[model samples]
Target chain A: MSDLTLTPNIDGADDYYAELLAMHDGLSREESDALNARLVLVLSNHIGNRTVLSQALAAAALKPIK
Target chain B: MNQIFETPMYAYSRHADQDATTPPRHKVIVVGAGPVGLAAAIDLAQQGIEVVVIDDNDRVSTGSRAICFAKRPLEILDRLGCSAPMIDKGVLWNTGKVFFDKRQVYDFNLQEEGGHAFPAFINLQQYYLEKFLVDRVRELQAEGAPIDIRGRNKVSAVGTHPNHVTIEIDTPEGSYNLEADWLIACDGANSPLRAMLGKDFVGRVFEDNFLIADVVMEADFPSERWFWFDPPFNKGQSALLHKQPDGVWRIDLQLGWDIDKDHEKKPENVIPRLKAMLGDDVEFELEWVSIYTFQCRRMEQFRHNRVIFAGDAAHQVSPFGARGANSGLQDTDNLCWKLKLVINGDAPESLLDSYNTERVWGADENIQNSSRSTDFITPKSGMSRVLRDAVLDLSEKFEFARPLVNSGRLSVPCTYDGSPLNSADALDGPDRSRPGSACPDAPLTEGFLLPKLAGKFTLLTIDADAPDVIEEDGITVTRLALSLKNDPTLALKNRYLGEATSGVYLIRPDQHVAARRPSFDDKLFRAAIRRATGKE
Candidate 1:
């Protein structure tokens, strides 16, 4: 069982999105990629539960056309 | 072009001080006669303080600059007895529309909680604002108020001393020295006094230019603010359209950094840009045109010994939020009362420190907000631009995303939440009226609450009991007793007493809550008064 509720659970969602984008400013494309990877790893460690991590990963994955 | 700006309202005149053998020391000397400087002089004069206002220029500002005046400053001006003309002449507006590319994202109404005397905002040229303030000064003068405004009088040098400040003033005839117990520097953004004191504003200088075109035309456009982000007329840049009184419309177009500012301001170049924005079919005449580059900066300390800075001399911000002149008015509103108390020996000089504390906090808030708005309007990086566009794109559909659209969070009253003057809050009232916050206006059975409180230290008791007047440490706190029994609307109760059955609020002279309790306690009220007056 997974305990991940992803129904827009954040206040000021636009603020968060803008901050995330601003965090990448002045960084090279390769640096941004590495930064994103490191951020994923950091968040993964915080959510040590494998089931929730797998659920987040599955939800974030690109969807295919039917 | 209004001929009012050209008329020399305060033309050169020789004063008796210029010919005196010995320099006469003034109670308070204010430099600059712009809106902020005149406001400071008028406020001090109203408090029975002798104040002299000196300016290098003889007339009001030329252009239709600082077109937006928010409600808080209007209320302050009302208290100063000059809001009537401004409100009559200003274009009242509360609705603003935001656009992204060629489509409208959303329109917002600054839902002003009613029961206040003033509107949410007004668009009046800076010349009219200064002219009204100058007229009010004359009214005070006729009433024998100790206020004198000297035109063509400029302060060349300043010498700060222990008890007073010495200043060298230059007039049309010659130069003379004058002394003042206290000096107020409202000399504008490029403050000469700030420079003479060997101090400078320490903050960010935004790298962008904006062209302001004030057009005189009889248009059917509603009295509302219209902002465009990446419009068809100007690609990849922001633009603002605002209506002013007298059939004048203010248009601001963002120009990227590194451009020929002077060349861009030429009528040949400006007319074409205006034609692009407003189709060539529309008939209009260019009243005034200018280019401005803004910076968000302020002095580390607004007060330095006997010399205190106000208005643009103290801090400046980008014109996005309409914060510059509005916050400057707030600065004078905060300063005059404390200065009156200190000069009259009612409060300790340390009370002035709270002015420094609270206003610096206010300046930082204004700077931070305007800077954020600037960033959203002009993204520094490609990714930031993408994020900004995403917000705008989502705002077209999602209601939640609309709040993220920052078309310059307009100026509002600054609440001194963590101010030293604010005592502990013990009332379970609405957070809007919490300690250190400006008292939200509510209607009474007879009239509005703010006008009744006026500009005084008041003990506002709602459905509670307190004496008519309480004196503590040479300060008098008058009681404005109110009861919901008379108020049929329950607005006063809802605004002042939410969960609590009764409430007692000790409001400062500037109408900011100093301390509040569920009910009045004598000892606690006195202590709070002491704290607010800087005795504690």
Candidate 2:
């Protein structure tokens, strides 16, 4: 049952990761990698995106990427 | 006693202070009756002035704690007429959705880019908005109006002299001394008279703690706004429910920074993590449970000598983006029309130092946009939680990553830019720049909007034969004819008026446009009403 139809074009970062899997009915990949590094700096400071936020900060390797 | 001072505005100011031994002076007092000091004592007793107020609490604070009001604080509670009975006992909400984990990313409707007249939020229950503002300051003290409220009086001291502001009080008939001619302080956020004026509140504190509860539910859950990212029973928690008006529900969780704040008042460690994230035949009961702990602070000054400070005693944020009591009721609707134009000398006292430099630059930009929405919903490491879960897993297959997975940039509105009541047409062009922001609510007819020309001091022409520019010191225009099928973003009427010159605008009695001539020149509409009532 996942064609993802909570609809209304869900995108505030996938409706906050489907409201964090309906408030954690499931999640554990170390709590979805600690809420995806705070949702890639909160959706890269809100939608300025920076190339999928530098590929999610080089797949979460995170450093001073000046 | 004696029917509570037999109302005729406190029995004609206590029979015009029969042989006064003190207790009469008040061109403004107002300490804290809440709802931004009873909306600055009902907009300075509906502009006739006087106003007293006080309160150290004898009533009104059942703690529902600001239950969302917005639509610009219901057009500043429809200019003190009490927003149609707090919008007929509140609960409007125009869609908000956002859940990433259970998959459903963004949904904001707010009646999609529409006009405005109240609908874009309204929950009502900050103790019934302070009992509908203490029943409109007891119907302006039974329609006589000098306004005085007392309530177990408290202010235990506050000197400031230069032409009045003595204060002292302690009541239960034991101590007293009150003089006024100015003193505001909507005493909150521990503002004991802004700590008896040694001011300097500065910022940032967050280590995150949240918890809140307020339940009742028999779950069918539909009133939108749920939010739960990564909530496996408190593994780095984050949950939020909402919907409240009777069958109640206001949840919120977040807990991080390693628990133990009195083991979060165990109800068996919070009812099995709210019955494991609300399921298992959802029942519900909790009704009230708190824990909160945020601090984004502000007050470097919201006026000092003569006293003034509104809401959370001038700034404190981190309810994420509820923008702390709607920016403390827009700092009591921008310091009640600049303290009713400097106690009615119609401006000067340096327009009350531009209400502490535009509400301390709107409380340091709403505490840095609610601390960048609490660091994008709690990301304190683990590579910022794997870059916030790879942007919620590439916002589930991008569309230019859906407005960065729907953040709407901490709901816009924060613009003052070096204030001193900003001018050069509120700092030059782009159709009257955003001098201390808030205005933007367009779309006119068809179920009337354009902020129902919000509470007064409006102009907004858009050429319905634009002429009558008023302001010989009465400033309350409302024209609004606007066309092009009411507004297609009109991109600010085609970049500051030229799609055949129309929109005049102006606004500000805290509805905020404060200059947008584009065309209808009458010395740029009386210099945008003397630079929005600070009489340039």
Candidate 3:
């Protein structure tokens, strides 16, 4: 349980990725940025455990910016 | 041995012997006599502009359609001078409950801003709304308002010129032509004018279908909205139950796509489903039923030279939120004042562009919210369904997940946050009275703030010494003072001033805050009014 649970939890990951891309189809850069911000907040609220979220954030930051 | 609630017939005797050769001209001709068209006509006539309204139908809507009237429309109608009778006839409701299967999940009060003049939502038949508006129009006509509402007059052809539109109308007697300097189309989703112009309403059409049933039943159900997701009786579908005046209950059952609409509409099929939801012991007579598939769409542009679109002609959304008619009323509210200003030469023609800008923004907001609600209610994919079910399940346990449960987002008036007409609030006032928002109505000593601020630009000086009412050609300045601390629970003061001691608010004819200052300044106040009206 302590291990970072990051291995493809969402079923049909490719379809979800396509859906995510389609959601940003018509939005401007600023609107897309705002959407990302809102998504972060909403998902953060869903994952209510603060330590788990902190661990996820740290794990995410470990990856270098492309 | 049966009695029917027949709509009183309206006599349309005025007929011009003109065809395309000798068309009678008017300042503005509004098509469709639904709530939106009548409201637009009444608002325009009140603004001292003559209008001619034409409708294909001769009576009020046959069924109880568009039953949910939001507070924003109630306030607009109040300004138009016919909200009293509507409020009396409408069933006032503010609370709603959400259920998952057999368990009650959450409830909402819509605890609207305290001291606001109207409740959040009122359930009234569309027919009663039309009847009251027509009566008001007749009374105004008798008192020398140049507004003519011709029933059974349908527009068969529409042609737009640079300065005017010539429409061919087919009447019961015969068809004739009329010209208008401007044409306001309040026609519904299947707008003939839009079709004639070849403009398509652009957006998503969902595959889900819902059967809306109105039944006349005498039951002890509370007058509140109840929504169920996969309720026990309805098996795996969603259902909604709402109360209306005259012992009518509206039940919307989610019937998945590809179902035979005619078969589902049959009493034999409808009664069993309703019986499952509301036990077989309860007797109800079927009144009306319709199958609806949600379509969230809007026109690219609302204005086309001399022709403008309002109501469902301009935009449409899913019925989940009560956004359809409420947003349409706001469309007319935004439009009539601008059209009047342009016609009377108080503002330039370019002022109309702001109406298009603001209402399109409003429509997009409504469509987005409505689409989100529809998506949550009818999850299309397996992943979406799982996530939605998780949210619903978690909503029963966790308080944080309650907001995620999107049963239906109730309609709220959209604020034009970045509108060009909104003057920056220098006083750092409260959000309620901020620029580009409808001024929060509070109980003024005279009456309510909204109605008192109608028909002209108003300068409201609150918590300050009463300044004599300023009389401008198209502006009115009224000053009233109520001690912020001494006022009743400080609701009014909080709505207007927040922590500030005194301020002056400049409001537009539609009751949107144009500008606000900590104290009165003649130069700054007039400048704000000029900018708001595009006189600058």
Against the true structure, whose TM-score is highest?
1
Best by DockQ: 1
What is candidate 2's local distance difference test score? 0.67
Residue by residue across B1-536, what tens digits does model 1's lDDT show? 57988899989888989888998999999999998999999999999999999999999999899989998999899999999999999998878899999999889887877777788789999999999999999999999999999999989999999989999999889899999999999999999999999997988988889999999876687988999999999998999999999999999999989899989999999998888988888889999999999899999999999999999899999888899999999999999999999999999999999999999999999998888888889987766786688678767755556777787877889999889898988988898889988887777778788887778999998889999999998999999998888566777887888878898999998889999998889999999999999998
The full ranking of all candidates by TM-score, starting with the best, is: 1, 3, 2
lDDT of 2 by residue, B246-307 (tens): 66777888887667977885777888888887876898888667787888887777777688
Q: Which CAPRI category fits model 3?
A: incorrect
Query: What shift in Å separates residue B516 of candidate 3 from its native position after superposition?
Result: 1.2
Candidate number with the higher DockQ (2 or 3): 2
Stretches of candidate 1 off by over 4 Å are A1-22, A33-66
How high is the lDDT of residue B56 in model 2? Answer: 67
Clashing pairs in model 1, backbone N/Cα/C closer than 3 A:
none
TM-score of each: 0.93, 0.33, 0.87
Considering only chain A, what is the TM-score of each predicted structure?
0.81, 0.24, 0.84
Give the Cα error of residue B392 in candidate 2, in Å. 5.8
Docking class of 2: incorrect
Per-candidate interface C-alpha RMSD? Answer: 5.2, 7.9, 13.3
The complex in candidate 1 yields a DockQ of 0.18
